[model samples]
Target: MWKTMILLVLVNVINGQCSCSKFTDESSCFAYGYCLFVNGVCVEQKCEAIPYQEKCKSPLCLWKDNKCLTFKAAESTCQTLLPQQCTEYQGCYYDYTNLKCQISNNCSKLEIDQCNGQLGNGNSCIVDPFNNKCQEMTDCKSLSTEFMCLSQFPFCLYQNSSCKPSSCNEINDSVSCSIMDQCQWNNNKCEIKNCQSIKFGYQCNGKTCGFDKDQCFSCIEQYGYQFFAGLISLLFIL
Candidate 1:
């Protein structure tokens, strides 16, 4: 009777062990995803869920732009584009209107200025020449100098220090040079003169002789000029 009881106890223990047993040997492991069953007992890595972090998106998508960053990192990024102010958040770049991160702005970087004149060095300043004020544009398109001409009131030195044509009507029709670097105020009218063309501009006859205006004006007709500039627009295309 005792021997019979022993056999029954062994069978129960085996059944219990087998209930959660997994494949331990290679052949058995192949049967399962990657489980291991040893001595009719399971020995495998338990599956657990990884907690999600609100601050970070899944690493799968890949960084089109790493604007979704930590506070410090976001600050640094904004400083590069907007020197005036920068706010921070997680999962997207700083937004001006809402002042929070919602989605990628696909930052349009405008005014990557060195701030040499008034904006300051290593800092960028968005220039609104129309209103004669400065704003800091961030996450913007490429920073470009617009050379649109604008009319103005007479005798008033423009923010750019040039006298605009007098307009009798309320509508101002000031026009600016296409090439900003080459345009400046000379006397009372706008003029085109710069390092690249200064040597050429000063001496119309050529540097071999002294500076000449008539020859220079003639040459300027080929290249564009400012205000009542040369007549290049009237003739040449290239």
Candidate 2:
């Protein structure tokens, strides 16, 4: 029985399923088919094999370097290679440029004309779909919401007309709200808040307050007349 036990242990070691506690480095673990290197240790990870086409998705095409590689392939390669592989399909193409690999039509020329402007002015321009001509870009200040601004231009305006994403310690006003609906200016920074169905003259935050004017007035009175007098005057009418 002891000899049989010893043989089983030797077989397990030969199969590369032995514990990696003896090894300190990742390379030793990798040599045994362990894929995860974590917190100064190597461990076995469960990986499910998915189909190449579904795993790649759109703008992401599979290419053969040696094995199948899935990433954003070039327009020329995507349209040519993928179409030939499956005759039933209209063929796939990488949708975006830069780092992203999306499957869509080529809009590189149209985007270039819009950004640089066909007329060659420093002013940013975009294709006006109505006229099909490049038109000068509008400022975030001119637009009502951040979504409108970003939808039109690449960036949105800050409190000082500076273009940037809402970082720490920014004011959450109408302009900021338009940029991202989920964030609110709280404790000197943009924070996630529930501003939906906000009651008049009441600050919107995570918690819901009663819409009843009497209860609201009673709560406000505790803070003193000078603090909430204006708020009471506005919301008390309803």
lDDT of 1 by residue, 1-238 (tens): 6545555443333222121232234443323322344555544323221121222222111112443332223334333433122222222333445443323222223222221111112123444555554443321222233322221123222334433332223223234332222344444555544223445533322211212222222222322234222222322332
**Candidate 2 lDDT score relative to the true structure:** 0.37
Compute the lDDT for candidate 1. 0.30
> How close is every model to the real structure, measured as TM-score?
0.19, 0.25
Most accurate candidate by lDDT? 2
**Per-prediction count of colliding residue pairs?**
15, 6
- Which window of ten consecutive residues has the lowest lDDT sum in model 2? 213-222
Residue 45 in model 2: lDDT: 41
| Per-candidate local distance difference test | 0.30, 0.37
Task: Point out where model 2 deviates above 4 Å.
Answer: 1-72, 80-108, 111-148, 152-155, 158-162, 171-238
Give me the candidate number with maximum TM-score: 2
